[model samples]
Target: MIKVTDALNRFLFENTPVRGNAVNLSNTFQLALNKQNLPLGLKRALGELMAASALLTATLKMNGSLVLQIQGKGILKLLVVECNSEFGVRATAKYKGEIRDDQTLFDLIEHGQFVITLDPKDGGQTYQGIVPIEGNSISAILENYMLRSEQIDTKIWLSCDGNSAAGMLLQKLPETMNQSTKTDDAIVHDLDAWNRIGHLADTITDEEMLNLPIETLLHRLFHEEDVRLFEASNTKFFCSCTRNSVANMLRMLGNEEISSILEEQGKIDVNCDFCNTHYSFDKIDAAQLMVSDVAAQSSKEIH
Candidate 1:
């Protein structure tokens, strides 16, 4: 039976020296797709991006969020999804032209750039990297990104349907050795093994990727090799938007702008593109928020 859960799993291999992760998002995907009418092709693409982002987020050893974004000049104009250490996910996509129901990544998007950003929650430094449209597939672009920018040996496999997305990542750990020995040779050997493993991973099929269970899939890919799998961390689709949050955003625009918007439209309407959640701010509500902000500032000054 198909297990219904949002999980992030980590694994390691023996003798060959590599680590891997498999992330599956079902509940999160359903939550993200709720109340939105998305074309099948677009839905698949978004699901793949969602799974990719969740897998990437799992690799983070620090407390932070990872944003995976794709921008193109073709029918698929933009797609963005983010996953945080807390397993919270949110996503949105925009497109143009004729969206075919059977369109693949290359069919919907001709030319695009993939960008990944790591933002730490603890106010640490953020890391951003950009990759050219290297391959026709999202996984290829991600592998290329790691090689060009991070200079790490990495592999990514992504699959998505309308209601679920799943992905796997395999990375070779940095070499460690004794300075008194021929350690450079060992490092090179490990690098060769990493490449070989990546080649094996390239043989994964779309059907197998999407349908097979995590344990079965790993064994199918690396049965002959020594592989260890870890427990799965759950993921969920969540949007950090609410009436209060929208109110605070209006406060940032200042009272004059809020007043002008209220005067013109009678109410300030803010719609979250990610979740399509709407928030309205009437003149009275805006005024109260402004007053509250002023009062808080005054109290701070008094202290």
Candidate 2:
């Protein structure tokens, strides 16, 4: 199989109690935006959020999706990013008022709760955590959440320049966290290694982070340590919307609501916000949908 150029990478310090993830998004980032016009600040925020979400998803052992959402009460009305186990990603943003290009990512948000949701693909139990907005940048907000809520010492750096997005994460684990067999001296060395590595990572400029390839970037940052790079996972821009999903959504609107819309408009037209795909349903389609739902419900009852 062909390798994925835009990918997620995992690396480990062989002798240190630290692990890291770096993601570079090029075509995927542009595809995710998909012609949705947004302000400069909001676009920057969305790009960083997408990169961060992809990195966090790689850290999990989940065959599902991780969603990052920010409900803003200011110029940036809202932002959402979702990354799945297979690395399929999609995002959307909303805003009002004027957003200056010079505004910081945090400046767009007056107040909001940061929410992280883990949704299993196989109908497994979902988990969600909401935290107060404590940090300014997307990187800072995620780092704060990991440290406070997940009890992990995580440092994240993310940058996006409309065309591409990149993010790097450094996580410090306790000696016992991984159940490693090491002497006290080794453990002490691990602690020191984390400090040194974090410092090195900090020295990486945004220009290098956004332009350098992941392998070159890793080698440059951790040349002193024995770094093990894992197989890269493919990533792409994908919107998980289909005609059936749209039908189910319409059913949830109830028959009375559907009739009102159909009677007034002659046909019901729906659009997917993430992908901008259009779907239209006429009266005949609506009737067929009702019949199909009844048949599906009856089959389930029989089973």
Candidate 3:
């Protein structure tokens, strides 16, 4: 097996209006899990989404974050993965009941909604597109979204084997790809290339994807084509959970309740759902938090 690093590699077909990305996460996958003892089914599902999120984030090249989520009514309540501009990623899932190893992601979900959110870091309005989950695999569901919502022809392949997560994405560049005018033959040729490349990518196997390096994998798939591979960007585990955010959450529980808990336990502890980091506040820290919260609210009311 190849040494699969946590990175995203972009590529472009030299003569066709097509582009792609390949990503494999090993260390990132383990970090994303944060040592959570999860069922095999849910663990694999979350890993796949984490890989998919990295590909999509690279596609948009957005600054803030891109969130891919599935909300369902079955045993798997919610699964979400967020990837930021720097290729940092994190994922978490909420599920109950026994998720057997034999059951797949789709088998554990029911009447799920697939949501893609693009949140800009520059205080821009977040954009979300929601659609009913219609595919059995994460690849198919995201491809459907790209085709339906963006009208872009996209193909994605994702795989995870509890140890690592890997995926590849190919998109047929739309007409607005360039300002240069093209003749009808040029348009036809581009379409032909897109079809051929997609077919080649379809031949990838899960073992190859999870174990092969990105460039080697691409070479095997597109050996005859003129493909340019770009430098890879690292994908690492990152969680935005902070002490201040946890403090605000404690404030939401109300001062009375907070005091009651503190009086009983001598401290308050909060754990982030995304990453299993613990935020602990003893009496003094809790009291100061309450004092600031009250002062901020009072200032707001006065204004």
Top of the candidates by TM-score: 3
TM-score order, best first, reads: 3, 2, 1
Report the error of model 1 at residue 76, Å.
3.4
Clashing pairs in 3: none
Number of clashes found in candidate 3: 0
> What is the per-residue lDDT of model 3 for residues 165-261, given as tens digits with 9 covering 90 to 100?
9999998886457222445456556768888898998999999899888767888999998788878999999999999888888889888999999
- Tell me the tens digit of each residue's lDDT in model 1 across 1-303: 465368888887655557788878887898888757778877788898888887777767879889998888888888888888888999888887777787776776666888888999899999988877788778888888888888777889888867678888988776551121334555456556677777778898877776777788888888876677778788888887888888888888887788788888998889887889988777788889879888978999999
TM-score of each model, paired residue for residue? 0.85, 0.91, 0.92
Q: Which stretches of candidate 2 lie over 4 Å from their true place?
A: 1-5, 176-185, 291-303
Give every collision pair in model 1.
none
lDDT of 2 at 281: 99
Task: Report the alpha-carbon TM-score of model 1 versus the true structure.
Answer: 0.85
For each of the candidates, the C-alpha root-mean-square deviation to the true structure, in angstroms, is 4.0, 3.0, 2.4
Q: What shift in Å separates residue 170 of candidate 3 from its native position after superposition?
A: 0.5
Estimate candidate 3's alpha-carbon lDDT, on a 0 to 1 scale. 0.88
Give model 3's TM-score versus the native structure. 0.92
